[model samples]
Target: MLKLGWFSTGRDQAARDLLKVVWQRIKEGFISAQISYVFLSREPGESKESDLFLKLCQELGLKIYTLSAKNFEPGLRQNNREAWRAAYHQKVYEMIKHEPVDLIVLAGYMWVVSAELCQKLPMINLHPALPGGPQGTWQEVIWQLLQEEANETGVMMHLVTPELDQGPAVTFCRFPIKGGEFDPLWQNFKEKMRQIGLEKIKEQEGEKEPLFALIRKEGVKRELPLIVYTIKAFAEKEISLINHKLFDNKGNLLLEPYDLTERIEKHLKTGEW
Candidate 1:
């Protein structure tokens, strides 16, 4: 069975929901794996949100570990950030080294992992955009996509390298942001951009813009299924990473994102986009 090492800052309800969903899938025999440990970056009393996340882990009976990163080496964190980041992750490494994790999943983990630690372990993260697409937080990605008039955007799980969100994709699911319900919205966006430009529209209505909201809604619906099915592939040995490159069970090199669009959409909750 694939042994999972879960890493998350537990900063939001998404963290709690992701853990719940994965654990539910594991219980339903959809994934042939066990989560060996859930390593959090904050402990109790740090923040009400993270405390709730910690509580959820305990409630689910998963092995919970924490290393409070809130104010570690305050002066050093402010002065020499790289040094602090490395030292911080070194301790994080020490905390979970003995658990015998087969893979690490960055599920909403909010820290930039040090290169040293990236080399020491195999990790994968969920990126909101497709491979070779926009880079940055989900909001930035969406804004850039809107600005680019991108018709298609997708979700991907990629190997975690030192560079944030730049690693090669392992699995992905793509969906169109145009056609259907989006046509009128895109028309409006184009008209508005011509009137006041992208920045001005953003200032007026940021994420709430219809096109942006619709894009995010569709993307968010796919995110959980993508993560679950990716784990399922690892558990079934249908996919594996060899020398940091993705390959199938037959030793076939996967040069592109292993397209899971059909599979993910099949499992997605019924809705029209």
Candidate 2:
């Protein structure tokens, strides 16, 4: 079984829900791995959201370690963000160095990792865009997709590098934004765009825009599956991490992130992964 390390800021409901789902999957033997440690960047009482997340973790009996990035070395963090990031990650490394994990999963981890830390850890983050679709926060990515009139997008599990979101993907699944459910939504969006400019729609409607909401909904449905199945792939040795590069079980380098659309869609359709 692959030993997984989890990192998260525990900032919101999505954070807690993801942990619950992944833990449930593990218990159900859906993913052939166990989470070894969960590292949070916030401490108790950091926020009500995170506090609830902590309570759930305790209830689940998952080992958790928290270090307050909020309170750590205030002077350096104020004066020099780059140095602070490096120093902060170094301390984080020191704390978890003893407990070895085969892969570290970044879930809702807000901070950018340092180059030094990237080299030391086998880490992957779920980016809410296809392998080459867009690069930014999920909201930003969605906005860009709409602006581009893009017909397709996806989510991917990517190797975490010092450069934010530029990392090569391990696995990804794409879906079209133009057919079936999306058609009516896009038509409504075009009408709204004509009624009030795209900027106005963004300023007022934001994520609540019909097309945007559906896009996010479609993408969110896939995230938990994308992550768990990626973990499954790792646990079963279908994929391997060597010197931060991904390789198939047969020892061939993966030039691209393996596609999981068929598997994800199957689960979405028949509830079988």
The best candidate by lDDT is 2
- The residue pairs in collision within model 1 are none
> For candidate 1, lDDT tens digit of each residue in 230-252?
99998898888766777888888
Worst 10 residues of 1 by lDDT: 264-273
Worst 10 residues of 2 by lDDT: 185-194
lDDT of 2 at 239: 94
| Residue 4 lDDT (model 2) | 90
Top candidate on TM-score is 2
- For 1-273, candidate 2 gives per-residue lDDT tens digits of 889999999998988888888899899998888889999999998889889989999999999999989888989999998999999999999999999999999988888888899889999998899988889889999999998999999999999998889988999999999999899988888888789988999999998998999999999989888988899899888899989999998999988778999999999999875
Off by over 4 Å in 1: 269-273
Task: Report, for every candidate in turn, its global Cα lDDT versus the true structure.
Answer: 0.89, 0.91
Off by over 4 Å in 2: none
